[model samples]
Target: MRDTAKAFGEGPAASIYAGFADLVSIGTCIAEWHAAVVAATSDADRFLRAAKEKASIWLKEYAGREHLLALGEIAANVSSVSTSDDGKAVLSKLAKQPLPLGIFASHPKERPIFDGDHRSVGKEKPKLAVAFVEFTIDGRPVADIQHMAPNVTHDLELHIRISRWPEKAERLVLTPLSVESATLYQLPTFKVSAPSGDPPFTFSVRERAVFSVPQSFFSRPLEFKYGAEFQPLSVEQPVEVVGQRTLRLESVDWQRNPQTGYANIDQRILRIRDELRRWPTVSQDERAICLKLLVNLAKHVGQAVQDNVFPGVWSEGQFQIEVRKALRNDPSIGSALQEHPRSAGGIGDLMFQGVPIELKVETNRTLALEDCKKFIKQTTSYAVGNGKRIGILCVLDTSPKVNPPFPMEEGIGILFREADGYVLPVVTILIQGNLTPPSHFSR
Candidate 1:
């Protein structure tokens, strides 16, 4: 048995460890066998059989019993004795020495430290604003305060109760309220107020979704040309007559045709000619209407011309290329144009890269003097706003030009000496002709 124990200890197989365990159980059984051997005479075999069976069962059931078996194997080898009394003495000595108590002694009971269902507020409590606490024991609700050491604020409320048999410890459940204020070190120096007053107005994300196109999209230059010889008509009132006489005379004078019953009607032609000669003097209303229509048409044409020029794309490729190249060559104009493409032409003129010009046209019909003044003021304002120094270019399209007595610099007012007058004012920023660079030169 001692040699067998030594062989088992030296073996590499895990089953050797099991064999060592069996060796220990066998030693214990041998102690029982010694008793049986001492007490029984003929039934010693039965005693030995029962002791072996009990030892085998114990070796199989005990955890880490293999380690004990290994120790037993060593002791048995050293003793090298076959007597059951020696085996009993070895077992008793091994039992007397202290053995490991294992992990069962210091094992802790598993329980949640934090109550997950309760909310805590104020100083010294859990940082979470909202939470829930739950307590239970023996598969039942055991709300006990003693078992839990909760660092709670004054605002919190604790709920406690008993749940299971054999009362172990008080289970605690904590609930927190909205904390109005909390002080440091439990000091009463500060107080907080509950949220009051109306909620602040908030802008909706959708409100800023409006789409807008840039002003540059609609910017362009407008040009108006006025032919010379325009003039203003004089206003004349109809004279009132003191008395008038109605005469009815019957003259049976007639002209007859000499051929095919058709008359030459030379006398009727003469009478019609006479009436036509007097028509202008008799029909003042028709003359007024004609004058008004002419004025309206002139106004419409001027506006239309402005509309055509301003914010208009170049229709001719040549024009577009020339303008683009010119702008690129002039540093000031090019820089301005690069910032706002719509102001390209105007910027060019303002920078003296091109000839700055303005033109206006008016028909024979006269506009109110105040209206003309207003027009001049507005045009000046617009020019100044656009960063340009402007001067008027007047054109007379009628027989005699209406020139105002005031200087053109003061306001573009024109006075006329004859009827059927047409006039226009062109506002322009003058570019120095001498400053024009060579066509080949680049800015």
Candidate 2:
């Protein structure tokens, strides 16, 4: 019973072995096909050699005929040369004379010895005659020759000087010399006068000439910045002034007086008291400075206003002083007034990020200064609160030599650490000579 059970399990294993044998038979058939493809590829090299030999034989048989056909096609497309009237005239002149002979002798002794004897030796002895012709054409020396005759056979001796030869063969042709052909040759040297100068320059005998000029003749001194001028008000208003002043700071005009070597500044200022009466709130310091500026301007332009030369109304000092007293009593106004400039600084233009900045002004000096200081203080406080830094980039247009009193005329100074524990970084840049973007900051 144990043997019968073992045989029953082996029966399934035998069927699986039969299935694998069928798969192996199919793989053997694919291998045979791949071997046949390799054998065909191996024969291709021999076949290509036979094809190349056949093509070479065909080309050799037809090469001459193919070349002649190609030449015919090219000739059909090209234009033929026609003789012009000048060319015909030249040919007519040549037809009248006998063909010229060309001879070259290395030794002076070998040169023809012509003692007025036209006859030398008869037949069997070569007869020779020395025909000396110093030829020139268009004033240029062509050839100096002593021709030996009897050997001269053609219409023209194609003898050409290597240096003076035509660049193109079509321009001049050289043919064998013969009788009835005229020979014209150019001389080697032509006289040319030198340009008018200290030493009269002269040229040697040659095919071409060259001349030169002195370097001093082409150079001159260059003058720049002649009679250039600018206005003071157009000069950069201090950053402080730009932020504070109430002066309706108008545009600046630069005018020059050629006779006086001076520039006049026309600072346009408009005084409107009605606008002043409408201010709801203003600091006492601003009112005081405004009053002082008006009082000073009045005294300066008093005669001009009276004479009708200047057009503007002057303010009352008493009314200005009273307004200042009222502003001083207010706590908020007093705090804001404390930040104004302690001393008057020269006016300068405003610039930011290397560009000019425009601002509206009230034409009030004290108010302008106060606004400028307030801006500085606010920027300072903001920097302090955020732990960040503030930088001031000052740009000036004038030369430091003329505007020596201006603060920026001096080289830039940076203010970094503040005494009140508020730190701000200020960079003052002076733009003097050329209006080039500041190199101090990198893009």
**The candidate that achieves the highest lDDT relative to the unseen native structure:** 1
lDDT of 1 at 312: 23
Candidate 2 global Cα RMSD: 41.1
- Expressed as tens digits, the lDDT of each residue in 76-135 for candidate 1 is 342343566555566665555443322221322233344478554423211111111222
Local error of candidate 1 at 10, Å?
29
Which residue segments of model 2 deviate by more than 4 Å?
A: 1-375, 384-387, 393-408, 416-422, 428-443
lDDT of 2 by residue, 296-318 (tens): 22222222212322122223333
| TM-score for each model | 0.16, 0.13
After best superposition, candidate 2 residue 128: deviation in angstroms? Answer: 99
Give the per-residue Cα lDDT of candidate 1 at 208.
Answer: 9
lDDT score, candidate 2, position 412: 27
